[model samples]
Target: MKRRSLILPVMLFALLALVPLLATLGPRSFILAITTRIVILALAALSLDLLIGYGAMISFGHAAFLGLGAYSVAILSSHGINNAFAHIGCALAVSLVFALITGAISLRTKGVYFIMITLAFGQMLFFLGTSLAAYGGDDGLTLAQRSLVFGAPVLKNDVTLYYVCFAALLGAYLLCRAIVASRFGRVLRGIRDNPVRMQAIGFAPFRYQLTAYVLAGMIAAVAGVLLANQAEFVSPAYATWQRSGELIFVVVLGGLGSLHGAIIGAAAFSLLAELLSHYTEHWAMIFGPILILVVLFVRGGLTGLLGGGR
Candidate 1:
């Protein structure tokens, strides 16, 4: 009973911490813009956290879903299909099918073998995206128009787009929280913590892992759609292995198992990139070292740096 009272305080603290950031930046400033990007990337990171932190699945091909989702919108819009629903529906379905097929096979292996299989699949997907001659082929496709949300221009305004992304980020956060606490989440957690024990209790580890993988893929696809919308372009670079590494970086940065940490990590990573890039062309060289330092000393990430409230 006493422990339950801690929740409100934690929530209030997190909200309060944001006040400083918000107060210091204008709506049109780079901070806010980067923050929105953080939210978008966080959605992808959150999905990876489910597979890695909770399910113990090391997926190196996760960005394939992102690429698939991005391409779905780009390809459809190229043919004059601009409805948001149509693009999103096709993206989700395709990503789910891909996840189901890949997860089924990848879940059969473990450790380095699982890692290699997923990496191989991701590379296959990357090359596949690079082969679409109709959509810029090796150069990638540029989105001529953004999807129309029910015929209304919900995403035409930068502020509106940011809010839409924020809402999606909020929804993703809530959904993840609910999922992590639900019965299915418990089983997945059980499998992660003790696969042998879960199987001993008649629970099939592969089945749960695969289900989680598919769900993660679907969510990751949603992120892909938002990301392409955010960037206003689709490219093979979307499916790069380096992007997958960044997703894993967020999972670890936010402290494994803390869903909201994904958001914080994304904001940190993106904002850092933006700020650093403003200084020089060799920004990534600097970013790499910083990431290494974080992994070495920080351990839990920004949320942890903030006392692990949310």
Candidate 2:
């Protein structure tokens, strides 16, 4: 219970940190860039936590949703449909379609099989993206300009874009928190703890799982759209298995099922990567082992290590 108290403080710290990032730093654009990436990834981490922690669905192919979102924005904007709402709608629609159809099949299995099937489907999308030679085959498609909001360029200002991503992160976290506390969430949690018992109670586990899957996919698409806007680009790399792994790692590192934990984990993970890469060219060589050890020794991930508060 005491661990739960850490949630508020951690969130406050992350929020407050942005002030200095936006203010004190010279050429603060770089810092804003870092903050934007962290916020966007934080949203993605929140989406992953919803299904994995609450719904007990482990998917290694989640990055496919990110690709879908990125492409939705890039492709539309490429053809001059630059409205933010249009791109956002396209992203969510594409992600929902894929998640629903795939969840129906993948949720039929359990555990390792579920993971494998999701990974396969995700690869299918990755390859499909690679084949889009017109947009950008092995390479990525770059947006000619930032997306239009109403009429002006809402995403043109780097700082404004950072705040937009931050707001989305906050919204996703709140949405996930509400979901986890709802009547539906209680059933989903029960399904995770004991699907057999949930079935005994006459609940259809697959329906709940699929619902959560689609919701998660939508959330991921939100992150993906923000990512495309930030980079002003979209690529097949967005759907790579390694990218999916990093997302899963974010959830586990944060302490599964804890919304605050996911945010903390994402911030820490992104900041660590940014910092470590600056000090060394082969940062992954050092970072990977550290993560391996954390997974090995700190079974609770960040929350477990910190004795996670609320």
Candidate 3:
């Protein structure tokens, strides 16, 4: 809410917006491509922060929505329906319905039970995706073409798609900032910090938490749509528990409870992985310890170090 609080995210987006231009100075397409992936994944991580950070709901299966969205695009594209609007609509619809059903059942539990239930649901989706033999099944499916905008394959252009994804990340960030600062956000946080107290004051914690869950799922689905386009493929792997863990890591690595921290964390994680992989195939061994150090020492993550852990 403060001007100082806005500075980091604004500057981050500004830098990201310039990346396509910056790419021209070097590896060009490769740099632009990786940057686009980071921005898309950042959007997914930002959505998770809405639940885990502000709402205190740890969903271990959130990536299911991402897989659903990506599959929506992949399936639709395979059927010769390349419309962007259709892909987005189907993605959001499937994720919204799935989140509503799963969140309803999962919200009945608390703490670890809630986490396990979400993970179970996520795995269910993962298996379902695997069983879709019509859509390439466990091997995954490739899109013959990216979604078209007004019959134009605008998203097929790397630079154009990069900018589009950049705008999406920026837009998602602003929308989340608004949500976390709104009356609804207040109710969500109240439920997060003290659910019993909130209920005593006439706020139904289940309703608010479920709403936040569905909202977060829908946002993640948006990221999935972008990711499917970015990769031109959809796989069960996208919805795996491991992918969910990475989203959690991104949120934590950037510091919990801060929206922009999600973006920073995503960038840091992506770049770190890219950098580490160049030296060793088993980069996770080294990357794992760095994450541990961040958890033990960083406290609030990079945002905390930068004094923006709000």
lDDT for each residue of candidate 2 in 188-299, tens digit (9 for 90 to 100): 9999999999999899898899999999999999899999999999999999888899999888877788777777678789888888999998998988887788788986
Clash-forming residue pairs, model 3: none
| Segments in model 3 whose C-alpha atoms lie over 4 Å from true places | none
Please report the candidate that would top TM-score against the real structure: 3
Error in Å for residue 196 of model 3: 1.1
- Measured with C-alpha atoms, the lDDT of residue 30 in candidate 1 is 58
Candidate 1's C-alpha runs over 4 A off are 1-32
lDDT of each: 0.81, 0.86, 0.93
Give the range where candidate 2 is weakest over 10 consecutive residues by summed lDDT. Answer: 16-25
Angstrom error of the Cα, residue 194, model 2: value is 0.3
Clashing pairs in 2: 3-308, 3-309, 4-309, 4-310, 5-309, 5-310
Q: How far is 108's C-alpha from truth in model 3 (Å)?
A: 0.3
Sorted on lDDT, best first, the list reads: 3, 2, 1
TM-score of 1: 0.90
